[model samples]
Target: MNVALYSTPRFGALKHTIQSEEQRNSSSGDDVAQPPSSPSNNSSHQHEDAQDLLSFGTHCDVKDCRQLDFLPFRCDSCTQTFCLDHRTYESHKCSAAPNQDIRIPECPKCQQKIQRPRGSDAAAQIQKHIASGCRDLVLLAPRRKCNHKGCKNTEALSFKCNRCEHQFCIKHMRVQDHTCSSQSIPPSGSDAHRLAKPGQSALKRAITAY
Candidate 1:
């Protein structure tokens, strides 16, 4: 019997078979790696989009709309938040409960529609109106000097002495401090208190409007 040599042609076929198997394995590994990477990246992006939508807060109550905000209009009748375009029940076609009345009343204090009260609050409304008027009064007051003779203090005229009938600064608010003329003072509870300073007739008119 003839013994086959280890480095013979038949043995070469064995080597070729092993090389082909390695090439096929490497090609299969590359294909698997590439497909998995693309799908994983796409899935991660989709997940990120979903998370963003959730963090963006509630959308408008109206169907087919997509306005989202942190301070959206909250409807008292329907108990839902909405955007500017659909903030009202009629505009959004909201399904409010029975006898649910909807109103987007302006705030009496701020005069802004954003801070609407849920129900009718007469006391709160009155207070808000009074406060708003007071703010306007403070803003529109004139700038003037202390009515005291020979004094050079000039600032926003805020107070008028009841005894002196002259506008003075906080530093000289007392009648005696400014040597005020008591004879020229108006009677208490008179409309002359509305006069801020001399030659300021506009202020009296403004106060009468209140």
Candidate 2:
């Protein structure tokens, strides 16, 4: 009976020690299996969120075309934001297009076209064009006037005095009829040409009709 009691106590102590060992192993296994949250992954997620906020799309201001555009265009005339299709003044039917668009001023002297920018003086551009020696200006002033001192006559065709190299109308074409210099000066290189050109009358008639 004494040996049995000693052996039974030893067996109970051994069983308690085995149970404690199993409980510790199970708890350690659970700790090792679970993964810890990573700071770098959390930071990457936050960066993506910030980028989405920064790259937000803009809505087109046009009432009929309010499409969201990642890269919207702004109208210079109306000063309103719009999509690619409605960015131009004509496309949007802007009322202020005339004021902000480029201006083409017609030359008063030569009837030529010149481009003038928005909000700039068109007269200044025309003056610049004249200052640059407009080609049409020379063609427009093809008519020759009488060089007689007191006569204010200009004709579609004028006769040049071969003796004094002066231009005159048919009435004073003779050297004595108008006060010719009488010096028998050589005809000027400019006035040495024909008295009546073919297109002079037609050009003068067109100008008069206009």
Candidate 3:
């Protein structure tokens, strides 16, 4: 009778062990199924983030010019990434009257009249004019021109005079000789200047001057 009792206890233990093993397997399978769902959720979140990055009418940081476009372009002036349309619009229009759709025969930034592109539609020609003027402004953005007697060579235009829409190279800007009607020079200096210096002092000076 003792042996039979021992055998029955052993059988009960075996049955319990088997039941526990099955439970463990079931729980493991559920856990395995959950992992796939998490990946799908993560993928959906990533896709949404990507979409948000590409929405239309987003302004490109390029040049701080208000050109808006789908693709971001490196501004030749500011070297910041900006949408194309915003750059065109900002370069062409006065900052104070940005909404005013005056046909910019000249580059608002540089005050230079841009030549019309041949065989281009009116809108296209206008865009070209704006781009050309923006280029000139960017090129001259590094130094201040000596507003002083006959010193046409700008002093490395370190500062932009928002009131005058002119870039002062360095010397003339220090004297505060230049005046701008609009305070629209990006508070930041040109991209070329930043890359050339990359010094905190240089960047600080540019910001303070702007």
Candidate 4:
């Protein structure tokens, strides 16, 4: 009877060990950790970032302007990159090149702005502008009439005397015809011009002086 009791206890301990092993296996299967990523994949991601950095260019070479850029202005002479504002040789002060040749022809008639064709003559373009009536080429003549009373002749307006407010033709531009006031008349020893009667034409006095 004692040997039978010992056999029963040994069997119970063996069964308990098997059940504990099953429970541990089930818990491990429920929470299995994933394997670590490969080094090749990490390297590929790093390579992609490097490629993106290589695609974009560096900053502008202009003074005090260090902005990142791509497709920048590349000078043919100096082969140096520059911003749009400093693309020219003069703007950047390039040592490899001088000033560029770009001249816009202007109209000689009225000095109007015009767009000129490549390899075209500037003089011909000016003539074309004048013919198109874009500018006046003819010398305009004056249409002002004579200031003398009862005179019906037109002449170029030239006189700006203070005594006579009106413009006069060449024939009537004299002070006698317009009856210039004493204040407007310059200092002269001639009594005919200084002592002329008021409201009366100075023509009679002028004729006597002449």
Among these predicted structures, which one has the highest TM-score? 2
lDDT for each residue of candidate 4 in 16-47, tens digit (9 for 90 to 100): 99999999999899788777899999999999
List RMSD in Å for every model shown: 18.2, 18.0, 26.0, 16.5
List the pairs of residues colliding in candidate 1. none
TM-score of each model, paired residue for residue:
0.27, 0.36, 0.22, 0.34
Query: In candidate 1, what are the lDDT values of residues 1-210, reduced to their tens digit?
Result: 135676688888999999999999999888876444678888999999989877867787676887876568887777888887776555677667333444544445555443224443333444555676634222233479887787778886556888757888888786656767776643434445555455477778889998
- Determine which window of 10 residues in candidate 2 has minimal summed lDDT: 134-143
Give lDDT tens digits, candidate 3, residues 1-210.
877976797888988999999999999888877444678888999999988876755564545465556666554434555554544435433233333343435555456554443222234555565666455322232344554455577454256554674556555563234443454533335555766675877889999999
Model 2 stretches with alpha carbons more than 4 Å out:
1-9, 28-55, 104-210
- Runs in model 3 with CA error above 4 Å? 8-35, 38-40, 56-210
Task: Give model 1's clash tally.
Answer: 0
Better of 2 and 4 by lDDT: 2
The lDDT per prediction is 0.66, 0.76, 0.55, 0.68
**Could you tell me which 10 consecutive residues in candidate 1 have the lowest summed lDDT?**
133-142
Question: What does candidate 2's lDDT look like per residue over 26-125, in tens digits?
Answer: 9989988869779999999999997897578887888988888889977666788888777766567776666644656788877877666555456666
Error of 2 at 16 (Å): 3.8
Better of 1 and 2 by TM-score: 2
